[model samples]
Target: MLRLSQFIFKETRERLGTLSFLINSIKFVTLAVFRILKGLFMNGTKVFNKEKIMQQNNTYVLIMAGGVGSRFWPKSRNHFPKQFIDILGTGQSLLQMTYARFLQICPKENIYILSNQDYKGLVMAQLDGIAASNILLEPSRNNTAPCIAYATYKILQQNPEANIVVAPSDHLILKETAFLDKITQALEYTSKNEALLTLGISPTRPDTGYGYIHFEQEAVAGVHEVNRFMEKPVLKKAKEYLASGDYLWNAGIFIWSAKSIQKAFQTHAPEIAKLFEQGNSVYNTSEELGFIQENYPNSPNISIDYAILEKATNVFTIPADIGWSDLGTWASLHEVLPKDASNNSKSTDHLHLEATSNCIIHLPSGKAAVIKGLDDFIIVDDEKVLLIYPKSSEQEIKSVAGAMVATYGKEYL
Candidate 1:
């Protein structure tokens, strides 16, 4: 009887030991699976979080290309502005070059072109791969204030935290690296601070064509708090400004957060702000075309500089030594272009004989051009018209084109 009882006790102990081992193995497998899943989930969350951060800090560049570049006429016409011309012989248009420059800082998706509705096809043809939806078209010419406000409203709708850089389409920059660096710094500064930043080129000469920004106090890292804004000054005043060393030429490159600019428009140009606000409700909707056609032309026509920058107290200027030119006139173009031995700029087919110095000749192929002993003259030939004038008369070219259009019914314009 005692031996049978001992055998039963041993068997029961062995069964309990087996059950303990099985339970330990099951717990080990379950813990291993849980750990693998947890690691995967954490890694996924990290990747998603990083992507979110990048998207949040991303910038949007708005290129204002709607100007009728009547100054560069004969070569630049109403059908195609200077921005679409390969004036530099670089195989890329000015607009393309500008887009490429900004691509270093912003993605293509974030870059936008605010242009005339008529130029939509031109823009699409030039920028083939870019999405068409990104291009914002203006119904009519309402000047810079409305254009900027509309672009700001649209961008803010997409990304409320968007840092926007508004740039002209036809400015010439010789120092691209320095220009891009200044732009990046401005964007970073404006995003972090609630300041309205405008890149002002360090005035190398007394250029009366550009507006000036007077620096109030000592500069902060090559940037200055703007004391006041000056429109195009007279020659003597411009010389004085250059000598003062506290002035910078307004380059028309502005950087500000969407919120900051919106507030500026609200405070200074409330009419433009309301127009855009109304237009935004119809953007991307079926009624977009009708909405703009009805409302855009009625908006007040004013420059952002006059409407906001000239009046705003929170304006700042970044002094950039970047080689800058507005390229507003033929004389300015000659200043930037390479000159020949006789100090003359001529296209490939232009023939210059006895042309001593200070002349620009631009003639198309199959056209004959001759300049004899002329100083500071501009000679341009297009398919429809030919222009020969002194370089000092650069400002009158626009009027000439307008007169030609009036007389010839738009054929010679």
Candidate 2:
């Protein structure tokens, strides 16, 4: 054993110079010491506050993915929405990516999906290991307020003390580590405080697409009190808010305890809250779907912003620099994807000779395209339909899709 150790040491010395070997040895020792300290620290966490840790362990995540993604037109259809397709060229779909992102902080069984009942099979096909019971299938489209209330009541049935994060399944997050860290901090803060916390993305530009959150000057526990919630403003107002340096782009991501949000609804949105509250005995049971189908559509169609956040006094905001995008439009997708020399983003293999500034996108199993002269246009080819329009006219695509469905049939939609 002594001879073997000597041989090994001699080989290591030969592979590395004298000083290099010593530095490597020091690094190894330092890493070992860090591991030991980390183990001790983690063990000590269990002793500090057992109940707090247990409550945190009950963290739940709900992903809302009911939109049809009409803006993406030919690529995103009613049956197969953007969330189920890999719009970013990644192997996983957007819903799958959202589920995977939360898996870093929450257990698999704790993550739930709130989507349209028509797309229930698609949700199951995209996400693995998700129980059918965890999918909250909305009987009709009632917007975000009713969607969130139903999910809250459902989770409350399983775990009343559940701390939940409600996020859109179609959004893109570039920095997973930083996003998870921010979520962890928000969860820890909301677990103790009776606060409705929403993750606010620091605005890089005066984007008119998203709503803005007005943050107050005072802060508590690294969270800012919400002064007001602004609707999507014109470019002029957006620039004013941006220059004022007091607004954050509302990312539609929220975190709060089941109790806190329930109370908020009870106080501000009593009518909608009462609808779900009446189902307390039926929730988590077989009669849940029937109860939802009967009462969900009757509830007022409103957003969580309108029904609660705008009216609730205990709302808070967490300013985060995590790279985020709602991915709401083709133009937005072009911003997050890689571009060519002439500022073109393509999905399929293409040969662009004089096509200077254009986005040439194609779904799989269609056709390879060759372009010669085009500038600042969108060239997308789905299997059944191909769209060629100016980038400036991207906003009209949704209307075009509706027109197609009206003129032709629902098959193309």
Candidate 3:
């Protein structure tokens, strides 16, 4: 009986030892995995914190929203331009979208809208979150140079070491992530260098509406030196540009340090620069408006492209593949929107009786529109004015809008 009992005790001790070994093995593996995952998580958090600091410290956006969008005729007007309206059926206006895109890369307080004084109310109403002071209003439409000068001087007064991105308020970027990434990279590049950088879109077709930028094929740290800037070219020149493999569509988006641009203006456009520099004392104060009104007209009515970019020797180009469109015309808007099986795009549902091939219509929802046997046409109904025009003759819209305004008064416009 004693021997049997001893044998049982020995077997039990052996089984307990095996269980202890199994538990220790599992505990060791789990601890190793947890440490590895914890290290990865901490590293990722460190990277994110660094990026956040980089954006907050050095980034500011200057959105130019002062244009009278005549090309968008019945939909866009002088009082309420395309930037304030939802040109896309996406429920957000172009200005709002542009604002939102920058929020991902910078603080909301850092974004400023440079718009006409007439549209101040519209800008305030659309972007309620922005400070009224941040909406830099122009007394009259002198052009981009004055607009940029005012914003730059004001921003410089606030933060001397600011890196600014000047972008049009009405452009559409289909790939928002890639757009922000490129802009982030640009801000980083401009922060450290005295170079002036502009985002250039790779040309997908021979588009005559856009200006062209010829760049050196060799790139320095992912940026190319600008060979030359060409105005909107004729069809033959545009086609040649497409074939050259060295040109990109100028996106009208620019990035530079506030100090760099201020210096450029001092060197190349000293007259305009001096006008704003004199207002340095009143820049971020209550006397700014009076100063701007007194001095804005003295500056030349020239675009920033002609004013500073063309003359600056340190200009560089970052060729970006982000899907972009200015959406200057109805035809361009149609290209971005989704079409039905019949290749007809519309903002509202409408009946199609044998209507086929590349037609766009904009009408209020529940409004009845019957389109038949039309191809490559544009139909817009804004309740007061209805425009049924051919897409091929879209360029005539500016003249047509002017004529209508002249004949029917500004109410129709």
In order of listing, the candidates' clash counts read 0, 1, 0
Where is model 3 more than 4 Å wrong at Cα?
1-56
The TM-score of predicted model 2 comes to: 0.85
Select the stronger candidate by TM-score from 1 and 3.
3
The list of candidate 1 runs beyond 4 A from truth reads 1-57, 284-287, 349-352, 366-368
Q: Pick the candidate with the highest lDDT.
A: 3
TM-score, model 1 to reference: 0.83
Q: Give all TM-scores, in the order shown.
A: 0.83, 0.85, 0.86
Give lDDT tens digits, candidate 3, residues 243-344: 998999999999999999999999999999889999999988889989988888788999998999999899999998777899988999887664555667
Question: What C-alpha lDDT do the candidate models reach, one value each?
Answer: 0.77, 0.81, 0.82
lDDT of 1 at 325: 81
Better of 2 and 3 by lDDT: 3
Per-residue lDDT of model 1, residues 1-413, tens digit only:
12332343344447658666334332233233333333433442212122332455668889989987899987888788888876654556789878887777787898899899889998998886988877888888878988888778878877889999999988877666567667777777888888899998889889888999898767676567999988899999999999999899998999999999999999999888888898677676778678777888888888998899988999998888766788888888777554555667555533646846778777774466556778898888886788888888888999988988898887565
Cα RMSD for predicted model 3? 16.8
Per-residue lDDT of model 2, residues 1-413, tens digit only: 22332344465568777778665632243233323333433442222232343346778888998989999888999889999988776566889989987877787788889999999999998887799988988888989999899989888988888999999999987656567767877888888899999999999999988999999867877799999999999999999999998999999999999999999999999998899999999998989989999999988899899899999999999998766889998888877554555666666443434645756455453355667677877777777888888878888999999898899999989
Q: Model 2 — which ten-residue stretch has the worst lDDT?
A: 44-53
Candidate 2 scores a C-alpha RMSD against the true structure in Å of 10.8
